[model samples]
Each structure stands twice: as structure tokens, then as C-alpha cells.
Target chain A: MKFAVVVFPGSNCDVDMYHAISDELGEEVEYVWHDVDSLDDFDAILLPGGFSYGDYLRSGAIARFSNVMKAIKKAADEGKPILGVCNGFQILLEAGLLPGAMRRNNTLTFICRPVKLRVENNETMFTSQYERGEVITIPIAHGEGNYYCDEQTLQQLTANNQIVFRYEGENPNGSLQNIAGIVNEKGNVLGMMPHPERAVHELLGGADGLKLFQSIVTYWRDAHVVTT
Target chain B: MYKVKVYVTLRENVLDPQGNAVKGALHSLNYREVQDVRIGKFMELLVEKSDRDIDAVVKEMCEKLLANTVIEDYRYEIEEVVVQ
Candidate 1:
């Protein structure tokens, strides 16, 4: 499967995401600049993390207006799997691709460390490789990672099984219900603050995040493979 | 010319850790009567006069960029300015 790693100015993790997909996962990947108006060539989209637009007005607020977002929206409507990590998650929230918004960490500090996440749901394309109720370690780095939404929206998320990952032991940034990641209602889009690409190597930390990438590839191949 | 002042704040139910920290500092400084505190964003915009309704323009800006309606509430005041 071909992947497009969206690159915005100040996106520090774009290379990491590319390396993870191309080297570790052995998938075709390329860096797609934020100014590009078309995303027709890519089968999957990855929005990497960084202080886009300097995180000026708000995290992900300014980056949401980038030209590429329109194409990303179009890709999402076509049911292409899209993953947003860290600042990318913030952008998805600001762009209304995913519900809710991020607030300052309850500690009012930029937290950067490894965190344990529980697989809340294993049916989605992103987490299908993870065992149900399995715990995995991934690194999180951000200040505005506290996720917030109304009570009603939270209920809908729970009912739809959209809550994909939850903080296993301790909530690092005080996210609501220890929510570490979530998917859209259609299950094609996922936004999470943790850096899964960073965890794809055992020497770097752990290879727990590789399965997520593998799951996406496996799902795409299964659904798209044609019989002659 | 017109001067527009905008205030953007978190919704009532949302938690503000920075505000809480500031409140704690005030308490430590012996300001006992402080009941609550909320931190928000304040922006000043100078807009040129035009035929379009100023209120509508400011409202649209607030909704589109200045404030995120999902978690924030915004209010703005517009004042006509007389240049020398």
C-alpha cells in the first residue's frame, strides 16, 4: 500500500513516520507537502506531529487551514485510512475530522515519556492487530494532549466502540477517561497523541507500534485484492 | 476605522490548569477572597470601515478562526475610531 505522510512547516516527526512505514513496515511511502491540492495517488494518509504554524493561536488551529486539508477531507470521505499522531491529532480535532478538542495537560507541562495504552477496541483497521484488552507501550510527547468532549459525545463514542486506546495504568496528561486515542464514527480516521511510529523499533524503545501499521496494510490488501 | 476586541475562553465545564495554578499562587500570597479564576485569550483587531456589516464580519472571523465553538466561547466588541 502507498502512504502519504503530510508535511507541514515545523512538522518534526514527518521523517520518522516515513522511515517507519518504508523501512520498518516495508511499505511504499512519500512526503506530501502541505501545499499540495491533490492526494489522489496515496492509499493511506499519515499526519505526523510537530508545532505546525508554531502552534500559535492553538495547537493544530492554524495548520487546519492548510491547502492540503481539503484533499485530506476528500480522501477521508472515500474511506481511506488516515492516522494522525500528536500535533496531527490536534489538527484533526480542529478540522472537525474527529470529535472533541485538546486542552493543556492537567499538569500544565509538556510531557514526553513512554506510556502504556490499553487496546479498547480491536475491530477497527488501526487496532485490529492488537489483541483485545492488550497493553502496549508507546511514547507520548505533547503539552495540549488532554482530550475533552461533551458528555453526550463521549456516550456516543463509547456506544460506537470508537474509543480505540485508553491509558492503561496512569493517565499521563489527564485525558478524559484516560483516552489516549480514538477513531471516527466510520472507523477510517484515527487521532492519537502518542507516537506510534517512534515505537516501531526495539532498539529505540519497543516494537509494539509496528502491528498497527501492519494491520492497516493487511486490511487494505484483504479488501482490495482482486481475483482473476 | 473600527477597533475590535475579542475574548476567547474555555467553556464553563472545561478544566483550566493554568488558571488553577494562578489561583493557587494568589492563595499563597494571602489573597483569601479569591473565589475563582479563568484564563482566556484577548485579541485586538483594527478593521477598515466598509459597506459590509462590521458585526457580521467579526462574528464570522470569530467562528472560523478566533474561537473553536466546540470547546471555547467568544465575545467581541467593535468601536468606531476617528483618525486625526
Candidate 2:
């Protein structure tokens, strides 16, 4: 499926996302600048990680006001799959596309390493390939990756089964409940701190992340394929 | 002219690791009386006098951009400047 990787001015992982989609996933992908006013041509939206707007005023705070965000919101309203990684996840939170906010890592340092994550729910489009309770290795790199939300919101997330991924062994960033990834109420939008694109190739590290992209493509084709 | 000063800090329920680290350093330095230390942000804005309500304008700025109400709290003060 065609994907659009939204690129803000300070986004450093845009190329990595593009390479993951175009080369590793072998899918059609394009870099959509932050100023773009429409996402009509893309089938899915990918918000890559980086210090957007230099992480000024807070991570993803300034970037949330970018012109492309309006379109991203509209895309979400239209039920198009939207996946946000790292700072992209922070942007989703700042833009109110996802619940919860990111805070400084409990250690107060920039952490960059491969983290083991447990797939909490495999029913969604993003994790359909994985078995329930499956564990996968993905890399996470961020300073403010701690996720915080009110008790009510956390309960709602649990009730709706929106929690997609959780830390397998140790909570590296001190995220609430060890939540590493989550999907919106509608299940079309996902926000996660780990870098799945970075783990798509075994040469780079491991190919555990490739299944997520494959799941999305497989689910899309299954739902959209025309029956004559 | 008007000078607007804004202060932003993490919400009470949120943990401030930097602030905690600083507090620890202070304790090691023998500052025993210190109860707590919270780090925050400060910004100053200069705006030209206009018919619009300055309070409303600054409030909007703080709500929309100056601070993220989800995890941080913000307060601001406006002062009139005299021009010679």
C-alpha cells in the first residue's frame, strides 16, 4: 500500500522511514513535507521520529502546529491508518490525536537501545501477524518517552483493549504500566515510542518489526480487495 | 508596549527527574533545609499596545503554545512599559 511519511523540519528519521517502506517493505512510499495541506494520495500515514522543531518548548509541541497536522487530523477522522513512532507519537499526543502525554525519562537521559516489547493485542491491523502475548524486539530512542494520562483515561484504554504493546521485561522509560505502544479508540491510529522501522531488516539488527508492516498491508488488502 | 512574563512547570502529579537530581545535589552540598526543587521554563514577550485585550491574548498564547496543559501548568504576568 502507498504510505506517506510526514516530514517536519527537524525530523531526522524521515529517510529511515522512507528506506524502510520503499526498500525493506517493498511498498510505495513518499516523503510528505510538513507544509502539505492534503494526504489524499496516500493510503496510510506514517509519522517518523525526530526532534521536530528542535524539540522546542517540549517534544512535538511546536511541530503539532505545522500545516500538515491539520491534514493528519483529517486523515484520522477519515479512519485511515496512522502510525506514529517516537517523537511522532509525542506529536500525536500533543495534537490530541492520541491520549496521554510524554514526560522526561525517569533517568533524565536520552536512551537509545533495543527494547523487548510484548504484543498485548494482536487483533488490530498493526499487530495481526503476531500471536497474543508474543514478544518482539524493537529499538527505542528518546528522552521524554514516559507516558502519562489520567486514571480514567488509562482505564478506558484498558477497557477498550487499545493497549497494543507493553514492555516485556523492564520498563526502560518508566512509561505508565510499561505501555510501549497504544492505538486510538477507533483502532486506526497508533502511537508508540519504539522504532519499528529501524528493526525491519535483519542486517540492521533483527527483522521482528517487518511483521508489523506486513500485517498492515495484509489487512488492508484483505479488507479492500474487490470481489467480482 | 507591554512585557509578558510566562512560567511553565510540570504538573504536580508528574515526576521531575531533573528537579529531583538537582535536589539531590543540593542535599549533598549540605542544604538540609531545602524541602523541594522543581525546574521550569520562563519566557518574556514584548507586545505593542493595541485595542485587543492583552490578558486574553496572552492567555491564548499560553494555552495554545506557551505550555502544554496536559502535563504542565503555566502562569503569566503582563507589565506596561513607559516610552520616553
Candidate 3:
């Protein structure tokens, strides 16, 4: 399967995402510019972390209006897997591809460290390799990773099994319900603040995150084989 | 021409960490009377006269880009400008 790593001007993690996919995952991956209008050639889309548009206006606010968003939304509607990490998660929230919004960390400080996360649901394509209730270590770096949604929306998310990852211990950023990550209602789109791409190799620290990529690839291969 | 001033603020129920920090500082300075401090953003836009209604245009701008309706509420004031 092929992957497209969308890169905005201020995106610093594009290279990291490309390296993880190409070198570690041994997959076909390319960096697609934020202004590009087509993603038809790619099967999966990855939005990596960074302060897109310098976090101007709000984190990921301006970047969401980029020309590439049209294509990204189209890809989302087509049921393609899309994983967003860190600021990429912020963009997904801003673009309305996912629900809720992000707020400044309750401490009003930039947090940069590894945190434990529990796999709330492993049924989705992104977390199929993980076991429910399993805890894994992934690094988080951000100033505005606090996720917020209305009470009714929160209820819907809980009912739909959209909340996929929860903080294992102390809530690092004050996210509601200790939410560390979530997928859209369809389960095809996932947005998480933790950097799974950064953890794809043991040299980086832990290889726990490698399974997330493997799960996506496995799901795609199985589905393709079934249909064709 | 019109000079529009837009103010965007977090919704009432949403937590404002920066605002709370500022409020704490104010309380420490003996301004205990201040019960709440909610910080927000202010943006100024110079708009040219157009066929579209100014109120409608401003509202659309705020709803679409200037502020995210999910967590923020926005208000604006417009003043007609006379350029000699």
C-alpha cells in the first residue's frame, strides 16, 4: 500500500513520518505538499506533527484552509485511512473531519515527554494489533493538546466507540475523560496527539507504535484480497 | 469602505487557562473584586464596499475563518470610513 504524508510549510515532522514509513515500515511513501490538489495516487493519508502555519490564529487553524484540504476531505469521504498526529490532529479537528476542538494545556505550558496510553478500543483498523486495555508508551509534545467537546457530543462519542485511546495514568494535558486519541464515527479517520510514527523503531525508544502501522497495512491487504 | 473590529472569545463553559492565570495574578495584586477574567482575540479588518451586505459578509467571515464556532463566540462592530 502507498501512503501520502501531507506537509505544510511549518510542518517539521514530515521527514520523520516519511522515514518511519519508508525505512521502518518498508512501504511506499511520499511527502505531498499542503497546496497539492490531488491525492488520487495514494491509498492512505498521514498528517504528521508540527506547528502548521506557525500555529497562527490558532493551532492548525490557518493550515486547514490550505488548498490540499479539499483533496484530503475527498479522500476521507472515500473511506481511506487517515492518521493525524500532534498538530496534524489539531488540523483534523479544525477541518471538521473529526469532532471536537482543542484547547490550551491547563497548565499553560508546553509538555514534551513520553506518556502512557491505554487502548480503549482495538476494533478499528488503526488499533487492530493492540489489545483492548493494553497500555503503551508514546511521546507527546504540544502546548494546546487539551481536547474539548460538548456533553452531548461526548455521549455520542462514547456510544459510538470513537474514543480509542485514553491516558493510562495522570492526564498530561487535561483532555476531557483523559482522552489521548480518537477516531471519527466511521473509524477510518484517526487523530491522536501522541507520536506513534516517532515510536516505530526501538532505536527511537520503544517499538510499541510499530503495530499501528502494521495494522493499517494488514487491514488494507486483507480487504484488497477479499475484493480482488 | 468599512473598518470592522472582530472579537473572538472562548465559550462560557470552556476552560480558559491563560485567562485564569491572568486572573490569579490580578488577585495577587489585591484586585479581589474581579470575579472572572476571560481572555480573547481582537482582529481589525478594512473592507471595501461591495454588493454583498456588510453585516452578512462580516458574519460569514467570522463563522468560517476568524473564529471556530465549536469553542469560540465572536462579535463584531463595523464603522463606515470616509476617505477624502
Candidate 4:
């Protein structure tokens, strides 16, 4: 399966994502420019982390207006598999792909550290390889990764089973219910504040990120998605 | 013309790490009594539409891009107006 990674001006994880998917996972991967208007060549699209658009007007605020995001929205509406990590997650929230909004880190400093996350749902294509309640180690780097939403919406998300991941311990960023990740109702789009691409190789200290990519490719292969 | 003021804030359950850090720094400096601190965004919008759907348009803006409803709450009001 061909995977496309969206690269905005300030995105720092596109290369890392490309390496993880193409070099390590041995799959076809492409870095799609954020200005591009189409995503017809990719089966799965990844929104990697970093301060998109220099974190102007909020972390993901400016990046959401990039031309490529318009196409991303179309693809998402068409039920294409999409994964957003870190700032990418913020962009998704801004783009309305997922629920909630991101606020500044309560402490107001750039936080860069490894965090433990618990797998909340394994049915989605991104986390199917992980078991429910399994803890995975990944790194989070952001100054605005705090997620928030009102009470009514929170209840709706809970009843809809939209939440998919949570912080394993410490509730690092003060995310609602310790939420680390969430998926849309269709389960094809996922946004999370942790960087899965950063933890794909053992040399990086943990390999928990591999499961996410593996699950994506495996879902396409098993389901015969647009067979070539 | 109508002027709207938008207040954007993080939902209560989410952590405001930045605000907490600032609060801590304030405490260290002997500025106490600040029980909690949270950071939010404020925006002023100008609209020329005279239709009663101003609220709907602003709501759409929030849903489409202005604010993320997943983890944030946003409220707006037409604070001023001139029907020129």
C-alpha cells in the first residue's frame, strides 16, 4: 500500500514518517506537499507532528488553512484512512476531522518527553494490532497539546465510542479524561497528540509505534482496499 | 455592520499545562491567592451581513475552522452593530 505523508512548512516529522513507512516498514511512501490539491495516489494519509506554520495563531490553526488540507478533508469524507499525530492531531481538530480543540499546555512551556499511553480501542485500522488496555511508550512534544470540550459533547463522544486512547499514567497534558487519541465515527480517521513515528524503531528506545503503521498496512492488505 | 466578540477556552477536564506553569511561577514570586489559571483565546470579528443568520454563520465558522469543538469551547456575541 502506498502511504502519503503531508508536509507543511513547519512540519518536522514528515521525514521521520517517511522513513518509518518506507525504509523500515518496506512500504511505498510519499511526502505530499501541503500545497497539493489531490490525494488520489495514496491509500493512507498521515499528518505528522511539528509546529506547522510556525505555530502561528495556535498550534494547528494556520496549518489547517494550507491547500493540501482541503484535499485531506475530501479524502476523509470519502472514508479514506487517515492518521494525525501531534500537531497533525491539532490540525485535525481545527479541520473538523476529529472532535475538541487544543489549548496551551497548562504550564506554558514546550514539553518534550516520553509518555505512556493505553490502548483504548483496537477495532480501528490504526490500533487494530494493539490490544485493549496495552500500554505503549511514545514521545510527545508540544506547547498546546491540551485537549478540551464541553460536557454535552463529551457525553456524546463517550456514547459513540469515539475515544480510542488515553494516557497510561500521570495524565501528562491534562487532556479530558486523560485522552491521548480519538477517532471519528467512521473509525477511518484518527488524531492523537503522541508521535508514533518517533517510536517505530527499537533504537529510538521503544517500538510501540510500529503497531500503528502495521495495522494500517495490514488493514488495506486484508480488506483488498483498491487492489493493485 | 456588526461586531462580534469570540471567547475561546479549553474545556474544564483538559490540562492547561502552560497556565499551571505560569501560576506556579507567580506563586514563587510571592503572588499568592491565584487559586487556578487557564489560558484561552479571544477574537474580534467584523461582519457586514444584515441577515439574522449571523449566529449561524459564526457557528459555522467555529465548526469549520475558527475553533475546535472537540477540546475547546467557544461563545460569541454581537457586541456592537450599525445597520448602515
Q: Compose the digit string of candidate 2's lDDT tens values, residues A1-228.
A: 799999998899899889989999899999999999999998899999999999988999999999999999999998888999999999999999999999899999999999999999999989999999999999999999999998999999999999999999999988999999999999999999999999988898998998999888887888888768
Model 2 ranges with Cα > 4 A deviation: none
Interface RMSD of each: 0.6, 0.8, 0.6, 3.1
Error of 2 at A4 (Å): 0.4
What tens digits encode model 1's per-residue C-alpha lDDT throughout A148-172?
9999999999999999999999898
Models 1 onward score TM values of 0.98, 0.97, 0.98, 0.81
Better of 1 and 4 by TM-score: 1
Docking class of 3: high
lDDT-better candidate, 1 vs 4:
1
For candidate 3, give fnat to 2 decimals: 0.63
Interface RMSD of 4: 3.1
* Model 1 lDDT, residue B36, Cα: 82
lDDT of 4 by residue, A1-228 (tens): 899999998899999999999877899999999999899888999999988888876778888889998899888988889999998998898877887787766555678999999998988889889998899899988877777877887897788888888998797766778888999988999999989898988999888999999998899888875656
Model 3 lDDT tens row, B1-84: 999999999999999999999999999999999999999999999999999999999999999889999999999999999866
User: By the DockQ metric, which is better: model 2 or model 4?
Assistant: 2
Better structure of 1 and 2 per TM-score: 1
Off by over 4 Å in 3: A226-228
Using lDDT, give the best candidate's number. Answer: 1
Native A-B interface contacts kept, per candidate:
0.79, 0.74, 0.63, 0.89
